[model samples]
Target: MATTAVINGERLWSALMAMAEIGRTPAGGVRRLALSDEDRRARDLLVEWLREAGCAVRVDDLGNIYGRRDGDDAGATAVVCGSHLDTVPTGGRFDGVLGVLAALEAVRAMRDADLRTRRPVEVVCWTNEEGVRFAPAMLASGVVCGRFTVDEAHAARDQDGRTFGEELRR
Candidate 1:
């Protein structure tokens, strides 16, 4: 027989509900458009949660956030898992938020279990994934993967003529 690790569903649900309140709208949707103030609050909350889970958190030049859990081996490359925190103008609660929260929960669960691996684990929150404010989704991942240059991603502008780089610097 195979054994499966069970996560605390109640805790996960609570975290999800808390996050849903960040950019909540009267229409029962999220308004965390990429690079908006609401989006920053959402990111800040996630970073706080990641830190609470004992992960070292960092944000890249392009505003992609990474939370890393160290393993026994210091030299091994990290195993990365994550999704974006940004959302459309009126996105659903589960769209990208769920993935980010789920990754956070997994890291929290691992910490609670005192689990260690040979390689560090990283949870990432890619920026501008929705491309609602900026154009061309997956901007941060593209920059990280070398498909797009950092300058290109930074130069991307939103509907209001604000640059991605400018907002990221704020």
Candidate 2:
């Protein structure tokens, strides 16, 4: 016999719809540039939802958000999941957000099922993935993995002459 983990499709759809409304474009797409006010709201909502699902949340220096859910072992390598939350200036509803929301839904489903795995699980929301607003896409994840330096990323500027670090600090 195989056990199945059930997830609420309606809940996931609602969450996606809610996120889409934050930076909705005139053409029915999203325009959530990284470090923008709309992006901040979406980030806050993700943190709130993660908290409601009982995850320990933290935001890194480069603005990557991590939500960890503990499993049987206390000191184990986590099974990481998730993707960037930021989208291009006029991106579709599911562009990068679906991966983030799917990870959240997985955590929610695990919580609902009371399932326990051997290793911990963590969901990460990477920052500044779309280069439309900030130069050099995948900045946060690259900085973490040593592919790019923090100083390099911080110095990156937008079309409006605002630095990545400046927007991050705002």
lDDT on C-alpha atoms for all candidate structures: 0.87, 0.91
What would the per-residue lDDT of candidate 1 be over residues 1-170, giving only the tens digit for each residue?
11233577898999888878989999998888888898999899888999999999999999999999998899999989889878787789888888888888888888777777779999999999887788899888899999899999999998788899999998
Per-candidate total of colliding backbone pairs:
0, 0
- Name the best candidate (by TM-score): 2
Superposed on all Cα atoms, the candidates' RMSDs to the truth, in angstroms, are: 2.4, 1.7
Give the per-residue Cα lDDT of candidate 2 at 106: 92
TM per prediction: 0.94, 0.95
- Which parts of model 1 are misplaced by more than 4 Å? 1-5
Worst 10-residue lDDT window for candidate 1 reads: 1-10
Question: Evaluated with lDDT, which candidate comes out highest?
Answer: 2
lDDT at 107, model 1: 83
